[model samples]
Target: MRVHIILAAVFWCGFVDSRKIRGISSSYKRFYRERKSFLCIDGSKILPFEQVNDDYCDCEDGSDEPGTSACPRGRFYCTNLGFRPHYIPSSRVNDGICDCCDASDEYNSHAHCQNTCWNLGQRERAYVEGQMRTLDEGLRLKQQLIEEGVLLWREKQAQLRELQQVAEDLQIKLEEHRRRKNEADRLKEQTLKALEAGDSGLIRQNSTVTSVFQLLDSNKDGSITVDELQARVALIHDEERVLSEDEAVALLGGGHQMELTKFRHTLWDILTKGDSVKIKDTLGAPDSLGGEDPHLKAADRAAKWEATNLKKVEEAYDTVNMEISDLQKKLTIDYGTDWEFLFLNNQCYKLKVYEYTYTLCPFNQVTQKNTAGTEVSLGHFFCIVCQTLTRRTVCVLGGCGP
Candidate 1:
């Protein structure tokens, strides 16, 4: 009977042990499912707690079973009342040092950890609030600046409208002035055309006389002897003179006789008579009228016209320059000083005025000035290739002789 009792007791104990083992296995599987680290050796999903304290790394990230420290690089968070939550590495999770201000890293059942997390949490909250307050103040200042910018924009818009009105008025005046100038130009052009026509007629007449004279003087000897020339002169003067062999050769053709006679009459008549005469009065002396110097009078009239046009052009240019100056001033006021303006007006002016002939000197002088310890006032050099001024001394060295 006793033996039977012992056997029964042993069986019961074995059954209980088996049940406990099964329960542990079930719990491990449930935790593995929740954490998704099950079957880690074969790359299957299971719970984190199942592999938490396993000697071998089971999960790829090793985030399982925070209670039993396993993975060295894992993180754990401790909830501390009245204190900011803190995270510690898995290696420190069970180090028994109680590093967390709240001492929450130690399990509630553990005896060694103490509580100070509430004070740390309050301090952290206060620090964050202070930062928020500073940010709020800065935001308010930015808003004020934005308002000022808006007001400035409104004023600029008003100024732009005024400027536009001024521009329009100036444009209207310019158009009127242009119209007057154009009319004046047209009148001047007509006068010039009339003068050109008169001059052209005289030139044509002169050309005809020249052609006739060239035909008569076929040998192109330039001049006739006094005796031979007298014969031709006498033909116009109505006197007698002797002709020579040279004269006979020169007067080979007689077709120019009538034209020459007509030319003589026109010249003498214009010089002697002062009144305008009909074109048919070719046999009479010219009328010398009024003692007027036509050449001088025409030149004076042309000068007067040019002066008037120049004045008008100057006025137009002045108006344009004024507008440009005003626009430049407005731009400078709206934006800032323009570096390009300084560069063009100052630097370029200096380069143009002083640099033209400085390039003819020796390179040694240039180098001396460049390296001079004192404030050396070195002149600029002219670059023949680029047609600009430069300070570089070595450029174009040993080139063509100056």
Candidate 2:
């Protein structure tokens, strides 16, 4: 009877311990009452939470009672079987850590755990350091380029200053040249006026001789006819001479022509031989009678004056044109050979002319393929001398396509 009681007590204690290990309780029963749910472990479905912790896998995803350690191929609890317990990435759950090579990490009651997680951490650190080194090298090159750009800017500033100074000096020199040329022009005008005054007396005497000759040839026939002689003699005397036929014949002959020529010479010598004699006669004549002489002299003087002035004006215009042409040539050389001077905004503007020619060919597809697959050929050349483009082309016969 004593052995039976002891054996019954031991069996009851084992049953109570097993019930505790499986996590079976009145609350568990109440929670799963009348509910059709499954535990996910080892790809199987089981009825209640009592079966969830029965040291068996009963859920497909091991989602049932994740806090427990009853499911295989599910979450495991390690009590550090031989080393320190440590958490790892979910992918490393069953990867067999070096510290847990005995698979003790899958047991909830185990206490020995070890960790060897330094290799992955070291690899990440090394990669980050390499990236940082590359970034530092690139930053150093960028800084060097910035320094070079600053030095180039300073050099350009110095060149600009020198150019400005040279431009100012050229302006001063141009002004001085203009002033000297104006002074020379004034002196030339004064000299021309003096030379003109010295020839005035001789001009007056020549004018009187011209007038006398013009009066002798009043009909403007280039010769003295009988009518002109009659008119002259009538002005000096009221008597008229009637010419007989024989006398008229003798006058027409060359025998009496010498006498008439001598008479004309005598009159011209009396009038124009000496300036003093001409001036004396001019002063002695009545003011009303000689009024015509002064008017004629004034007209002659004006004509001579206009001729001299016209000559000077022409000379000045030629000088100005020559200087302008020289300046244009110099400007073309300084700027570029293709540079042209255009008048705009009341000033001369230098402009460059660029000329080129491109040829377009209209041909059929077959011909285009035969002609190196080219639709257009450009034969381009620039003439710096004349700044022009010359293009020539031969038309393809019957090759154009619609």
Candidate 3:
């Protein structure tokens, strides 16, 4: 009777807006039969249906409950026309999380969620664009530094090689001098022995010694005068040996001739042995040459130069790599799984407060420095809180700002 008529009206409720009609996909151009009859979504049952948006479950598969939270497995579709359509669980439909910009999911919520999806979309667009722009600029700068650092490292290495070669050349020169000294000593000893054995042909170990002495006697005198000897003596040793006039003449041993006998005694050791001791000193004494001037000073300077440049190049190379590593880590943290954020790597963000200046160098670290030359480390960029703080702050956007 009257109750049967109400029940019949419920089974015939057809699909309306978004819900599938009769819970099945069939061409129903015209409801030739009685239009009030309806089928369950799974075709397992039949019922007379009306407005299904009544916040009640009418099907086992929850197909009859689309907008309400009556069914846990029900899916709600959001017609986010300003952005894009999306779906969410029925349980989260009215959870107050603003999952949908259209606010369709919160239709039954006690807390009023406004339809601010259009404004939110605009803000998101602006933020994303700004982030990309800043990232691009920051990346460009970092790339420049990287390029400069690479070239610097290469140039340093080349200079080092050149210096090393100079040092090696100097080393070779010293070794040759040593060999000559040994030969001279052997010759002097042999000549001395021959004189004692009465070999007249070997009276002078070397005729060149006599010739040099004669040239040093600039006054055309057979002997070296005091003034003549002292002037030339400074050139013989690696360090200057300024002999007084009397001291110079005393080297002659009361001889009228600047003979080989006198010349062989004073300053002769270095003349024969080659002043290699002072040369070895310039290299910072890495070794004694396994035993241990010139040409000796030039070689010394070259060796020292090479050592200094080698250290410089090593430090630069290490620093560049560390900077690159820090930048890469920071980029990932700032923009989750997005490669565009890599542009922000190695970038610095700075803020100026009332009396202090704060700086955050992506991935490297955070630091605060006052105007009075005082600096303190806030934390490393890798730390979660430290990185988050840097992102959340916009006091004075530096290189990473768009």
The number of the candidate with the highest TM-score is: 3
Candidate 1 least-lDDT 10 residues: 334-343
Q: Tell me the tens digit of each residue's lDDT in model 2 across 1-402.
A: 999999999999986655432222333344333345544434465666456455455566544533354444444333332333443222334343432434444334434444433454466568878999999998786666556545544554565565455545655644544543343343334334434676435434443444334343444344545544333322112123433334432333433222334434553453333321122122223122133343243233333333444455455555555555544433322121212111111222222223322232211111111233333322211111122222323222221112
Indicate the residue-level lDDT of 261 in model 3: 66
lDDT of each: 0.43, 0.40, 0.53
Q: TM-score of model 3 relative to the true fold?
A: 0.41
lDDT of 3: 0.53
Q: Highest lDDT: give the candidate number.
A: 3
TM-scores of all candidate predictions against the true structure: 0.37, 0.24, 0.41
lDDT of 1 by residue, 1-402 (tens): 999999999999975543221101222444433333344433455554344444445566554434335666555566555775556775666567786676655543354877876677678888989999999998786666566555554564676666576667666766654554454444445445545666534423433333323222223343333332323332222223344445433443322222345434443244224342211111223212224433223223333444554476567657656765655443332121222122121122112223232212321222122223333334322234223334343444222223
Which regions of candidate 3 are displaced past 4 Å? 1-64, 83-89, 92-99, 106-114, 191-203, 207-402
1 against 3, candidate with superior TM-score = 3
Q: What's model 2's TM-score? A: 0.24
Ranked by lDDT, top first: 3, 1, 2
- Please provide, for model 3 over 1-402, each residue's C-alpha lDDT reduced to its tens digit, 9 standing for 90 to 100: 999988777765532333433211123223212346556457665655553545677777666566677777777777765565667777776777777777777755686777777886788788889999999999897677666655544554565565555555655545554453444444445545665687755543344354344334444345666666554444323334465556555555554336556666753444435433111233233112112112223223333343444455555555555555544343234432223344455689999998899998765678999999799998665553433655643232222321
